[model samples]
Target: MNPQIPDGLRELLALAAGAGQAPWRTLLRPGDWLLLLCCAALVAASYPLLWRGGVADRAIVKRDGRLVTELALNVARKYEVTGAIGTTVIEVQPGRARVLSDPGPRQYCVQQGWLSRANAVAICAPNHVTLQLAGRGGAHADYDTINY
Candidate 1:
């Protein structure tokens, strides 16, 4: 049997054995560093645009396509909103809100759990109800990636 090293492996071995300077110093040029810095800056800039965690102070509850009422999240309370199908119990705590109960067959809104972030929404399509968290700007606050 005959054994032979591949051309790429042979070249790699030669480079590793003969190189005097450090591999990073030789591999990374000024332009490479500048590119890396630019990429890092782009990533840093995208954070604010992509991840929006606004301060939510209230929740806006809508039913049957009309504005029903606004509930303050700071004061914990439960409000029953009448929708097309039935009543939906909305529970609000400090900086958060959720659908405690819904008359819809599929409890998608109830299963959504707590919503504490601005622009976070829980929609009960069957009941035509929507519960959305809002900041001081109301529902006009900048939306997060999920909402956008």
Candidate 2:
């Protein structure tokens, strides 16, 4: 018939309620803000590292230190560039470019893999071929004297 909680149980409950409770700022602790700040800084710094292809829409292929071709990235196609060494096969996709094959000794350009980010380059030293990603924005500015 006793509806009231026992004295010891009530006291235990009161202590339990306050034991884990603290001010919001105090609960965060001293080093937690530093960790939070570092995490926030990391996320902020990663924004620029992310590749954006809005204006970086062209794949330019250079042969023998000269610009041989510039292809729009939106158009999917395969381009062959003949240089002093030999022909290089460049495959272009939307916002990306890569060398399918090249007449180089080590095939380094093919190993360099795809170029989707602005200002990224794949160079085949033996074949004298270089492919670079370009943007139409102010910084990129339509070739901007890429000089191979």
Number of colliding residue pairs in each model: 0, 0
Q: Any runs in candidate 1 off by more than 4 Å, and if so which?
A: 1-53, 138-140, 144-148
C-alpha lDDT of residue 144 in model 2: 31
- In model 1, which residue pairs have backbone atoms overlapping below 3 Å? none
RMSD of 1: 5.8
Note the Cα lDDT for every prediction shown: 0.86, 0.80
In model 2, what lDDT does residue 64 have?
77
**Index of the highest-TM-score prediction:** 1
Model 2 lowest lDDT segment of ten? 139-148
**What are the RMSDs of all candidates, in order?**
5.8, 11.9
Residue 8's lDDT in candidate 2:
95
* Candidate 2 wrongly placed segments (more than 4 Å): 1-55, 138-148
Residues 62-133, candidate 2, lDDT per residue (tens digit)?
887788988999988999988777889999988788999998888878987888766777888888888988
